[model samples]
Target: MPYWRLSAYYFCYFAFVGAFSPYFTLYLKALSFSATDIAVLMSLMQVMRVLAPNLWGWLAEHLGVRLPIVRLSALMSLAGFSVFFFTDSFAGIFLGMALMSFFWSASLPLIESVTFAHLGTQGHRYGSVRAWGSVGFIVAVIGLGVVLDWLPIMAVLWGTASVLASIFLCSLAVPEAVRPLAHSASASLGDTLRRPEVKALLGACFLMSAAHGAFYVFFSILLVDHGYGKAMVGGLWALGVVSEILVFMFMPRLMRHYSLRAILLFAFSCAVLRFALTGWGVASAALVAFAQVLHGATFGAYHAAAIAAVNRWFAGRLQARGQALYGSLSFGAGGMLGGLVSGLGWETIGPAWTFTLGSGFALAGLLWLVWGWQPGLGEDGTDRPDGGGR
Candidate 1:
């Protein structure tokens, strides 16, 4: 099944994410970009995700060859990122971030589709494999934080480029999984998306992610402003991912007893609490640490459950496009709006209030789900008396 090859792609890909997510704004801040400007550029990254994945998904689903497209996308991501090495000017860096994000965003949804195919009937074990990406994120975030203690903050670019290069190399080792033929009665993409269940799911996903905008863009900066060291900031970031990894490890068990609906509801509820604690508890390290622990629910459980839900909702020929839609709508649209609004909030109301605003989005999602979401089965409708661990 080329499992390690697939795992390598995830590992390298998220290692790049780890280096960027917690640290990139610090780099931009060092470059003298305003908080609003930083928010725009960061949101620019999400904006690319909105369009690029669907574009790649159409090509992959139509062309019938996923690996070649994945390889090309990885290579192009590296090329797009290289412009950062030569120029740090706002215009150049902005273009570089946008271009790099376009190709980079194209990789994940396609890779997710491929992973689900490889898992076949054992899809519940997705967390075990995905945990490696969290591991990679922890490693990069912590290691680079230590490195930045002595080196220049711009060193993040070098680390990020290295990981992107590894992603390209890893893509070379993996082959495409065989997709099932479309059933004669399979619904069209438009029709599937039109379903009430689908709309509610996507809308909830969007609002939940939008709630994360302030944290993803400014969490580290906020900590720094509160007198936390870069190393401590990295530790806090790793703590969240470490909790996420633990959740991923136990997801099979959780899914066995709980519906996707429950897991998602739990995630939304945790997010509301997590962001608020983060906003108001900045002066209390223990309180902040407790909030970070909720990341296990917010991102880890929520994402795994959402992916599994999307996998169940879209099968066969609709696989790639369905996954792409999840990314485009949630991370792309949700994240962009979050970043933009958080920027305004950060500039006007301040960080604590801005994060409180995030909590409001999550609360909105939780309420929406309670009103709309119904219980559902595992993707294939199989209850695993024996969990799918392989």
Candidate 2:
């Protein structure tokens, strides 16, 4: 299955995220862009995620191949990102981010489909293979933080570009899999989306990611505003992912013992608390640390659970589209809304209230999930105990 090669792809892919997520805004700040401008620029990526994945997914399904599309997307993203080196104007930067992020967002869902196809019946091992991505994230966050302290913020451009290049290179080595899905006579993608449970799941995912927009957009800026150093900010970012890595390590055990619904609910609960602590507890390192630890639930466990549900629900020809729809609805639509509103909120109300708004989104998502489940249904909306959704 070329497991290490797949792992390498994950590592490089998320290394790009780790670099861009924690430090890119700081880079924008160095360019003297306003909060709104930065928010718009960042949200542009999510906006692309909203549209790009579906397009690429449809193409993959049509072509009956995934790796070639992934390779093309990675290459385009890398080429697009290189534009950052030549321009600092808001218009140029905006165009570059838009072009690059469109392709960057296109790759993950396809790769995920490929990875799961390779895993076949061993889906539980997804966490173990995926954990290296967290490792890469930690390395990038910590290393870039130190470099930011030592070098200029512009160095982030070079660092992120380097990782994008690596992503393209790694995509080249991942062999394609041709796992034919067992089709059902009556099942279709539209039917799956129409199911009440599916709607609820996607809704919850959207709000959950929306709640994260503030943290992704402003966590570093918040810390810096409160007198934290770049290196410490980097360390804190790494700390959260380290906590996430621990959760990933134990994910198989956790999945065996709990329903996906329960895991998601728990993640939402942690999100409610995490954002609040991050917003209101900046002065207390211990409180902040406590909040960071919740990342184990908020992202790590939640994502694994969500992916499992999607896999179970979207079998056969709809697999790639299923993952793409999930990404678009959650990270795309949800994250874009989160980024836009948080920017306006941060500008008008301050970080405390802004993140408080985020907590509200998480709480809302939690409630939405609870409301979605029928009184006696399982994860797949079946009435059997073995369904494990209840």
Candidate 3:
């Protein structure tokens, strides 16, 4: 298993995210786009994920190969993003974002399936390998932040495009994993989705992503409005991921001691506190830093546990689709809703209230998880007859 190569892919892939997620909106702002317009553009990433991942997953499954599809997606996404260099008009930007997003969204889920397949029985080490991505994020976020202070905002375009090229390069080096044989009596995808625990898991994931909408769309802008510098904005984003890296490093120990359900519950609890502090505590630097630290629990631990759950629940032939479905519902559907709602509410309800609403979404997810999930469903699904474990 070319572990370092896979790690390199994750690093490059998330480096693009680190560059784009926090700074791209700021770039849009520099172009004098309104809050509504920026929101619509940013939401395109999530909207395309809703459709693209499932479509790409199906194709990969049909072809019985993932690496080729991953390579194609990476090439297409880079091509799609190039349109940004030539056009600043809203219509052109919108088209570019849509095309970029459709292809960009296809890579992660398929790669995740590949990664897990390579891991085989060593799935607990996923965090250690995945931690490189966080390191990449920290590098890009802080580096770009400092650069933006000196260079023009167009530097964001250049930096992101450079990373996208790296992603394609890395994709070329990752060898495909052997696909597992499908069992004749394996439960259909529809049957798997019908399970109560699966429903609760996906629902909670959706709401959790929704709860983060404001953070992704406006947290940097929020800090800037309150007199923070661009470099500081990058530092804060890096600080959150730094803590996330710690969580990922320790995740093997965490998995040994805690149930996936327990980790998820704690993560949701932190999300409530994190978003609230981010919204209401902007004036207090200490409070904001503390909130950022909670990112370990909210995103680092939460995502590790949630994706692990998806991997366990959706086994055998359904693996790729399961990952895609999880992405579509949670990050795609949920994030789109969060982005759109925050955009519409940013001016009307104000930033504080807008983020508080995010807290509400997290609270809803926490409650749903607690009420809907049964205890003692082991990670390998040993507790239930259907092998449905939490």
Indicate which candidate wins on TM-score.
3
Model 1 spans with C-alpha error above 4 angstroms: 376-390
Candidate 3 lDDT at 232 equals 96
TM-score of 3: 0.98
lDDT of 1 by residue, 1-390 (tens): 677888888888889989999999999999999999999999987898899999999999889878888898899999989999999899999999888989889989999999999888888989999999999999899999999999999899998899999999999998889896665656677776776667778899999889999999999999999999999999999999999999999999999988888989999999999999999999999999999999999999999999998887677878899899999999999999999999999989999999999999999988888777655533343422222212
Would you list the C-alpha lDDT of every candidate in the order shown?
A: 0.89, 0.89, 0.92
Query: Which numbered prediction scores highest in lDDT against the true structure?
Result: 3
Off by over 4 Å in 2: 375-390
Give the TM-score comparing model 2 with the true structure, all chains together: 0.96
- Clashing residue pairs found in predicted model 2: 379-389
In model 1, residue pairs whose N, Cα or C atoms come closer than 3 Å (at least 3 residues apart or on different chains), thus clashing, are: none
Comparing candidate 1 with candidate 2, which one achieves the higher TM-score? 2
RMSD to native for every prediction? 3.1, 2.3, 1.4
